[model samples]
Target: MSPARLIGLLAALLVAVAGLGYLASLTLLAPAEIDVSQQQAYVAAPVPAEAAAPVAPAGEPVGVPVVDAGWLATNAEASGVPEPALRAYATAQLRVDKSCSLGWTTLAGIGWVESQHGTIGDRVLQADGHSSSRILGPALDGSGSFAAIPATPESTMWHGNDRWDHAVGPMQFIPTTWDIWGSDGDGDGVSDPNDLDDAAYAAARYLCADGHDLTTGQGWADAIFSYNHAQTYVDAVHSAATAYAERTSR
Candidate 1:
């Protein structure tokens, strides 16, 4: 109740007032209540103009290149092409000769199926003391004119130096046949069975020469058959050719 008590009481009162004012200011500055019935609308942010717009899918009747048979015959050297150049060459060749694209693809597939893309080998021994060998099939026919008579322990044909041989290379061409039919496919001036370009072009030429149209569906089938006489070979070639077309088109 004295002067000191009065001062203390006044200080307490001032503190209480200051606390109340701080709380009041906070409540007054607080966000207003959101409406219940009058709901707030939200809009998605606009996409940036620089953002790429969704691209529409290309419609059917998509442009596909068409290739000619005669052109393939003349450009048989194209098969010797390499890497990125090889792909572009193949694409261009197939585009112009897209009709024969199936034929080429079929040939490639057949080569794969027939000889594991030409990775087979064979050894033949002649009874007359002459020895000859092959890879893939028994050296075609006129390759060496030597008949493979199987091995002795096998009871198939030859006993010592006369026996049939396996095929080799990407196209599965016998060493002898390759010596004859193999050609430069990539324009590198060297015919190699291991070369995909050379192999592909050789196959194209072989099919074209084998009474295949290289331009029509039936021709494609015929060319495939000429490569190998197996039904599986035909089916595999067709499937591969179709797949190649689809991939290249994309």
Candidate 2:
């Protein structure tokens, strides 16, 4: 071949190789985004009334983390929850109710709605399952947008207020509720609501209380409404939980 023709052929080969490399890089760098509505339609179809599954009695505390790291990592990526928070939610299930009807996704929904898994307001959820900073809500002194809640004797210890009670920690539990349902989930023997592990376990126990069955739509709605009376809150939790379940199903 002529020198010019040979040079042109070499240039064409180089261009083709570069094009292939660009395509491969695109494939590796940008994965296909998850189709949430499609996944929910398929994987999270509404349960029939007759198909409601009963929750079993809560098991004794296992006193250990029960979720596999591999599973936690996979779900954390898929559901947009940090691995530490995901582990807390999953382990809370094993610690309290191992019911097939309720999964970690429900607790995760609450965590996300309440405090974004303790990362709300730019705070971080530490590796030890505690928030980098305290996550406290406004005082419930029966003032604007809040109901009146007189401070309990130990309220100041948790929320730094002796005049009025505030919702404390990642789960946003008021002092009275915390007194009844607080738990120690990390095996550290302290039931601190700021700790994700303990807070998650407390939430699970509260939701699963009195043999609540979460498989059916009505039952699940009731459980969430008990957490927060607002219908919008229940709907938001349902939406988040359904999305998480759909994402992790892949």
Candidate 2 per-residue C-alpha lDDT over 8-47 given as tens digits, one digit per residue, 9 for 90 to 100: 4553333223223323222122223322221010001122
The residue pairs in collision within model 2 are 142-147, 142-148
Question: Which regions of candidate 2 are displaced past 4 Å?
Answer: 1-62
lDDT of 1 by residue, 137-157 (tens): 433222443333223332122
Clashes of 2: 2
* Model 1 Cα shift for residue 38 (angstroms): 74
Q: Which ten residues in a row have the lowest lDDT in candidate 2?
A: 38-47
TM-score of each: 0.43, 0.74
